[model samples]
Target: MAKAFKYGLKGIRGHLEPAERELLRSLFDDVISMLEPEERANEDPLAALVGLDTDAREPSDRALRRLLPNVMKNDDDASLEFRRYTERSLRENKIGALKAAALSLDREHLVLTPDDARHWATALNDVRLVLAERLDIRDDADADNVHLMQDWAQAEDVESYLALVYNFTTWLQESLVQAMVHSLDARR
Candidate 1:
């Protein structure tokens, strides 16, 4: 079992069992793989260096679209134009956070600095978002239904297993956010 993260004298700290740590690391890696931009064989060096993807289009994957949403919801042209200029950097930033969070999972004691907390929060949220998409949790009602699957013994299918993972990540993220709030309050 993983302990909920809490803010205290030393820092924001928590404990994860070996299995929990492995699970989190795997989740983080999955999200990182999804966020990584594809390499272009004959791409413009200058444009790539400047983080511009001239041929960038909206992601076809529902989870990816959620991660990298349009700047303008109703206007396709504007959104594509903006994505071409910004999506690369956005993907890189997300991947960086996911990697950092995964690395932290290797630590014996889960003690996080403020920056690490932010990264962990980001990584966990991203994992939850992906899981939610897979679990078809489109609304509060859908999420509530999934949340009903609380027992590991009840995980008879892949959906049930995913729901359990989603619920775990949601709980973890919530605890992290609360600890972050406590850290902020302490600094005031």
Candidate 2:
């Protein structure tokens, strides 16, 4: 019989003494799966023609109904050790109007703190261009979107911030522990 397993698990073949690295990878995979395609729903004409229909377009869903959520609102990584996602959040935004808008945030004028969500605070226009100069936005549509983000994020004060952080941290811890437990259980 084997002595231990790796995924923080034990005894199972291919699972001996699993380390944090494996845990991280597992967690990363889970997180990535949760990353979501930015455009969740935009009205499919064919689906509309069916009479009664719905479009979930999101990563998390139950068997019967797909859910539509604002991306990263309830990210499962709240349980992890670090705030940084394995993938750079804006990797895809680099060449778009969103990228231009991102370059325009000044931080000083906007009174906008990093909010952990960092540049992802959605939009700065709602804050009255407080951080405008420091931003690099060029698209007028994105500017409109910023106006929208500012309104949405204004309410995300301390309590909500802590809640998000807590959720991510707890999620990571649980996944790690679960993976470990799974490995150990398999050992038997």
Candidate 3:
């Protein structure tokens, strides 16, 4: 079982079983794999013809498209240009968030400084976003539909597991956010 975080004067603390930590580590690994920029071959015929590499274009992966959404939705050229300039930095930030969370998992109990708590919040949000994409969950209605399918034996598979993880992460994120808010309030 996973534990909810509680804020302290020093920081925030939570406990997770080693297996739980491993599960989260694997999820983070998946997200990192999907988000990491890849090197393209210089021999692309398309690149030769267009004088640019198509692989250098905006993300073609569905999960990535969600993670780094276009800044300008209506204009393709502008969106692509913006993505080209900003996506690398955005990816690095996400990677940093994931790394912070992973570092917190090195022990049986997590102790996150205020900044680390913030990073964990970002990491949780990113993980949820990727999981949502893989699960094809578009809206709250879709999430509810997954819940409705819980009784069916077939639904007790990966879809069900993903939904459970999604729900769990949501609760965990909420707990962390609330703790942070209360800490801030107390300080104020």
Candidate 4:
């Protein structure tokens, strides 16, 4: 029973059919079965995140230098390729999250955190200009309803460098959040 719930948990966290609520119930049961009495204490995530000296961990610059694994951060082209891959990953993650949120809430109207969208609308439009001339994708631009490439344009930052120690959390989140709102509006 415990194993069944644990296995079901993976599906609950994933994009799947609504009928999977039965599995979600199993997952809840598994979580209960897995629960162990606290040895010391546990902090709620929001409190821990906002409180001072919360045992928050910081990664060194050296760690960041090696952040992009499997893509090889050692070489220059590899670095560029890795950045591209990272942007693609973020875009996919945000959009997928959007869909997931809509499904979870069972609402046609969905909203996303600003951090998810990363405002690059103007930048994306500019990229469209370049793609139009360079790749000759202009005339066919409106023809494709899905704006995959534009998302890549806003994905310009090679290193969104972790926000806890970095600054982009604010500037980037505002843009991203706005973008999500815009996207929701478009869908609506």
How well is each residue in 1-188 modelled by candidate 4, as lDDT tens digits? Answer: 11111112112111223433343333223322222112226655554333322322222223222222334446756545444435334333333443333333342222323332232222222222322333323344542422333332344453211111112212222444454555556558
C-alpha displacement of 79 in model 4, angstroms?
A: 1.9
Residues 35-103, model 1: lDDT tens digits: 988887999999999999998999999999999999997999999999999999999999999999999
**Whole-model lDDT values for every prediction:** 0.94, 0.31, 0.79, 0.31
Clashing pairs in 1: none
Estimated TM-score for each candidate: 0.98, 0.21, 0.84, 0.19
Candidate 2 TM-score, C-alpha based? 0.21
Give Cα distance to truth, residue 155, candidate 4, Å: 36
- Check candidate 3 and list the clashing pairs: none
Superposed Cα RMSD, model 2: 21.3
lDDT of 2 by residue, 31-82 (tens): 3333333442675656444422243222333310111223454664541212
lDDT of 3 by residue, 76-175 (tens): 8888776655676688789989988887788997888888988999999999898888889988898787555534245457878887777767778888
- Span of 10 residues, lowest total lDDT, candidate 1: 101-110
Clashes of 3: 0
For model 2, where is the 10-residue window of minimal lDDT? 122-131
Candidate number with greatest lDDT: 1
Output the lDDT of residue 77, model 3: 89
Q: Rank the candidates by TM-score, best first.
A: 1, 3, 2, 4
| Candidate closer to the true structure by TM-score (higher is better), 2 or 3 | 3
Better of 3 and 4 by lDDT: 3
